[model samples]
Target: MELFQNVVKLRGFLGRNADVPPSDGITEDAYTILHLATMSGTWDIATNDWKPRIDWHRIICPGPWFCGFTRGMRRGEYLEIEGELRDFEQDRTVVVVGKRYPAKHLSYTVHATRIQQLERPLLVVDTGDDG
Candidate 1:
């Protein structure tokens, strides 16, 4: 029987963009990003305290998304990720399959179905003052 769920969502900063192995045409398409995340889960209820912890996960964007992510991200950029968690074979384990968007310095890899940059847009304000 399935004891629990394997769904997760995370928003965190990147450690660095490291190039991994096995490129599917594009060289940068095999890159991986180490994400640093912090999350708070539902309270214990009994203890009336929430589970707040810092998590680090290794997120790899394979194929197309790999190239897409590399093009859109910078060092320490904030990203939001949502996906299904699974287990990988080697090195990077605990793979997440979905979109939106790691940390760890852990053993999880998020195969993103979608990824978006959470960068703040710079707005130019017009004060009617001609420069």
Candidate 2:
């Protein structure tokens, strides 16, 4: 539990520095993808003492749209994606399917998942309404 907590703190710090410049030879697009995969959501956990394990519904990329890239790729293109999550701190690793330029081919199915610690309060439980 303590190790997970430390990992969460580290993730938070890294997320805060998400806008920092990237290393040499790394394109802006690559950096953006990395950032999106790692730090795309708010961190909120149900309890501070324990980090919850989360199983996210597979995120399906519609058509040519990359996860965070506004410019769509096309309708049979496949991309390699890997992800990890601890509590609510989640990160995804994506790889372009082929060496094709402009990646026009679409994928039949593409999904990505990640784990991260959330920093928001959960919604209140719903109560039955009395008419």
Candidate 3:
């Protein structure tokens, strides 16, 4: 089976290099949606074992968290997002009410639990006891 290597913390720019859009994508199950393309590098710098690319993610923000993000997140701001990374296998065989089509691609997304900007976090998870 799988062992370890599932979480990631990235510091980068948005796909638009400014404003980030709302979370949007096809749901992975009943509770997750892949959203946003987080650009990790300027593409001008290349190193061995470094792949030139942009990382698309599904930063999980359940309920009010998401609403708050779109409202507070501004343009052209560099930030850090930390979360769990997972690869999901999707069946793209059906399109438009039962049309069958085959697709080839591996999907990897991040479920961000927190974001930081200039030593300040937008949201913090408080672990508490039920007692």
Clashes (backbone N, CA, C under 3 Å), per candidate, total 12, 22, 1
User: Order the candidates by lDDT, highest first — what do you get?
Assistant: 1, 3, 2
TM-score of candidate 2 against the unseen true structure:
0.17
> Which candidate comes out best when scored by lDDT?
1
Summarize candidate 3's per-residue lDDT along 10-129 as a digit string, tens digits.
Answer: 775444322233446313332323245565544344543435567665555434454445444544456677788777887565466677678655777777777666543365655665
Regions of model 3 farther than 4 Å from truth: 1-5, 17-58, 93-100, 119-131
Q: How close is candidate 1 to the true structure, as a TM-score?
A: 0.49
All candidates: TM-score? 0.49, 0.17, 0.47
Find the 10 residues in a row with the least total lDDT in model 1.
99-108
Q: How close is candidate 3 to the true structure, as a TM-score?
A: 0.47
RMSD (Å) of each candidate, 1 decimal: 13.0, 18.7, 14.1
Provide the global lDDT of candidate 2 against the true structure: 0.30
Candidate lDDT scores, in order, read: 0.59, 0.30, 0.55
